[model samples]
Target: MIKLQKNVDCVLFSVPPILLLGPHLAPALLKAYAEDKGFRVVCYDPSPGIYSRLNSKEQEGWPYNNFEEVFKDKALLLEEVNLWLDEVFKYNPKIIGLSTHAWASKFFIEPISNEIRRRAPGVQIITGGPVALDLGIEWKQNGWVDHYVVGDGEEAFLELLSGGTNHPNIDGKIPVPISQEAFRALPEPDFSDSDVEYYKQKAKGNRLYLIGSRGCVFNCSFCNVPAMTQKYRYKDGVEFAREIMNAQERYNTNYIELADSITNAAPNEFRKMCHELIRLKEEKQLDPKIICFFRIRRAQITQEEDFALAAKAGICRLKIGVESGSFDVREHIGKKETNDDIFFSLEMCKKYGIKVNLLLIAGYINETEEMFQENLEFLREIKRRELDEAIEMVVVNELYISRRTPVFDFAKDTGVFDNIDPEDDLARDAWQTQLSNGEMLDPKIRRQRVHSLKKFVSENFVHLKNLLVFAADEKFSAETGS
Candidate 1:
């Protein structure tokens, strides 16, 4: 017998994928709404188990063994969903909000949305996140989602929860189409009542995620940032430092993952922030590992001083969006980069002993096989060098074409995408068809190419590690006779 709580105004349920571990946008937005409407809010995240598996803490009572193992099986996902449904039923709030992002839409949104609808027909179901904006009309047509909030959700969500019309104004402190005021107003994310002990146990070591800034200035063709109208806004440097120190004191956090799209977009602002961080570290004797994502212009990385400062500030890992190896493809997609810039940036990061995660896309409009092979060969060369040195280099593939990105527009104009429905399942299925017969390589061929690359990486990873070590430590040359 399930008892319903009328006192509960809204319940926020966040379903994030295992691969992405960071502060969620929807949860933060709803937190603001809860504060505004005086509604009791609760967040249901399956991410604890996901994080446990990814961080290899599942051996202690969690279900999955590792990230790879958990993500490979759909049964595990179904089991997790059942557990989530049980938890949601226990809360039994009036309004249910489903949070989604692009990466986890297919795996997390579809199955859970259907189940929630079947069981809890009385509860109003709303979906918000990146996919909400990208596929809002499609979702609305499906009847699974009662309302969709596009752009920053804080204002729109509050109105909806207060029984306002479903389609509310997109104006408020937060920007509708790229304003920094809204980002500035974002209160410190409410993680106080969350299952801190559970996450801590999963983390195993000290771990913290910090968002020092919001939005991105660059409009990379494959990225969804531009469409979100994310304006670049920085939290006060001093305030950010205080948050870091507070987290350190509370959680004994040894690693800080900066959850910004580009950490160094405003070089001077970031430098100031880094200076404060360094001061805190030196004065307080606080030592924490740092990892961040950034888009490196050739000019920025070539400056030895910049790389040195980043290394000194404890930035051990850096992710760069090197979408393609071909200069022509880069220009075609509106990514302003030359081949020289890409190689230089990689070498500089290598020289600074920073781990590099290079993101590559395959199914771009008008992508040539020769271009892909060139990218593959470049990765092979990097792997070969890693055999001699002790630095880490990873190459990940991008398969999904984001609706808001220029690539989608290109696909539409080029007749690659004949039927572009916004519904998640239908659009995904339609995209698969395009992937099969479109200008890019056939689906079968793409799978074969990916499998071959994976095999090559698996066999040569050990050598790559050795090379990384060699690069970092001079003594490796004498020992390895390279």
Candidate 2:
């Protein structure tokens, strides 16, 4: 018999296929927002719980193993879902909200949603996040979910809790961006209901997540961020800094991962935040180390002093989305970083002793063999110049062709893709796609290129670790070891 928590209005779930390292940002953010609005909400993130039960082999394969593999094991998935359902019902809330990603929607979310419906017939079900925004209509049509919040959930979620429907961005209506004021007013995410200790131990530090902004300024071809978040908005510098301070003080963690599309998209706000962080370090004796995605802009706009300030403010690592090394290829993907810009950014980070992770894409719609060789030569140059010293990790991936991105439109317009069923949920393999230059940048070609790049990086730059090679097409190869 389950003993229900008194007066719980809503029970939130951070659905699986999420990283088990720390508390997920959406549930914690929504939990904070809802509770601040005087609703009694309890968030149940079962990722840590799920991770604890996995064997050593499964544990080692995590995140890279992904939701697809996990969901395939129906027995294991159901066993975990039943256990979670037992715990969830203990809260006996009037409504349930789930947060999921696009990748997890078809795999993890579908089955669990069905189970939830079967067990609790009367409780209203709501879902929001990237998955909800992308597939809300499909999920609703299938009767898997009652309500799905599309773009921003802060206001829509509140409206849903009050039994409001037919709102914009709700139930498959057009997306509505949250106001900057509302985004700013959002309180520090509450993570009290999570398995904080389990996450801390799993992460091997008190690492946590923080969000200072939403969306990206750049309209990269392969990215869906601009479409998803609607527009870029950020908190004030002092307010952002204070939120970090408050979270650190409450959670007893100095390490934070910024869940932003690009942390310095608003350079003025970024600078001010850095200054405030420096002040907090001095005045409050708080040393908060941060890891975030950063845009490698030109020197004129992004000065060297900015890196200096960032280092002082405890920005330990920056993940730069240098999707391609070739100038033309990068330009095609809407990344305008020149070789000089890349070198300057890397050299500056090296000067500041800040670690960087370079994110590269293997094969885009227009990548030719020559373009690939250009990419390889660029890597060779990095190794030759010992710029690899500044790099913590180099993440190489096969191009993921999502229908929601501009890249998909490019593929369709150019007659590059094979017959793709309109009903398929996840990003399909564009391996059959042929470039205008009569080059079939197929799976075998992409795999071989990725292997060659990995072999060079592994052999030459031993100190620089290579992160996940997201090859959605094939199994782990002996060369890359995934």
Candidate 3:
């Protein structure tokens, strides 16, 4: 169903609606791959369009409960859709690439695709990203896409650009590998995008994001990185330093957000990359600040020197995926790091003046009231420390069990299709879990606390309302001697 050879082999890559500062690096990387071989590559990003409308005055829906909520204002939705489709039609692309990173994006995909199909019935539609790869072929049958690159798309996309029709498929999905030759030739994303002015307005020329590696070394139960990439593949230290330099020089960017699943893979190599960046910074080649995702294994956490070096290299932020506060729950999720190790890592970041963001999860598979309280206490403990700007944020998100994750496997092992309905959209929310005993675990209590708890975590013990409320309440009760 691919319209591969429509006209001059132009590839139109686009990221779907929803906001995240700017366009993702996926399409840019695909553009780089295709352009290197002298193919015509075009782009159509919906982020600016989406952000403009959402932030516009008199916009009917400011805070949407769901995608349907925004669509409820039919006039607003249609206006945005028209603007988006106009951009798409500009290229008259033979092939179209859609970004499928978040499941929430599926909402916009349906409406957008319906419109695109109406406009260009013969266009070859391709989908790739985290969810597309994680769910595999079944994802393609969602009545939207005709083709999919269910793996690292850099090389596979290049092959497709070179006029190969037969895709690599296993169980009705194409999961192609980046050949060793292609791996060596992979280039940093081409960021001469149309949204440079938009990015500048958003973050003052610092909204750019890049990925040094793909896949995580740790396949946590709830994570989809391992299934998406199959295994960890990386760019070496020198190549990574070059990428940092290029992105900064070309984009005039101050902050570079590393979008790796876990940035510090293969410890020595990560250290080497940091040293290279430090050397580059000292030489005044590129003095760019960075934010990266990291894990807290013993080897990584115990080594303060590694983190200190990263701080010297200008890594300002580290987002740690600390799934749960309860050690038992954490171990169940295959997180081997202990509470002490996590604290030690935070202390090291603090020592080096690097800000930390602990990513927590609530309403996990089989989570109880007690465990949720433990999460609150964990947030409280972090607040109590008063590290004085060492902690940037604490994002306590709902745990959604996506395809190819251990949590999804657990759901299948428990009931498979008998109790859990894969096609049912409501069941897919992180708010619901189907227990093996046929009982359902819903996020009723969890949802009730999400707003207030998020508020408390963000503003508590800070210069805001309810300042140190936990400690203040404790002190007041103790002083009363009741």
Best by lDDT: 2
Model 2 clash number: 0
Model 3 per-residue lDDT tens digits across residues 1-482: 21223244554546454344545777788787788888877655776566555545323232222557656887777677778877666666777777666666666666666677888898766777766754436546775777667777766666666656455632225355565456657876876555665666665535578887776778789886777677677788777877887777776665888888888867776888888888877786667888889888785444978888888888888888887767767987898888778777877888898887667676677666666677667667766665524666565566666667798878666654355575554565533555545555665654544544555565563522211111111211101100
RMSD vs true structure, all candidates: 7.8, 2.7, 6.9
Compute each candidate's TM-score over C-alphas: 0.75, 0.94, 0.83
Cand. 2 Cα-lDDT: 0.80
Number of the predicted model whose TM-score against the real structure is largest:
2
What candidate 1 gets wrong by more than 4 Å, as runs, is 1-6, 16-25, 36-38, 47-86, 89-92, 102-122, 166-178, 203-206, 300-302, 380-393, 418-440, 459-482
Ranking by TM-score: 2, 3, 1
| Candidate 3 displacement at residue 355 in angstroms | 0.7
lDDT of each: 0.61, 0.80, 0.66
Q: Find the 10 residues in a row with the least total lDDT in model 1.
A: 467-476
- The better-scoring model by TM-score among 1 and 2 is 2
Off by over 4 Å in 2: 1-4, 66-76, 422-427, 475-482
Sort by lDDT, best first: 2, 3, 1
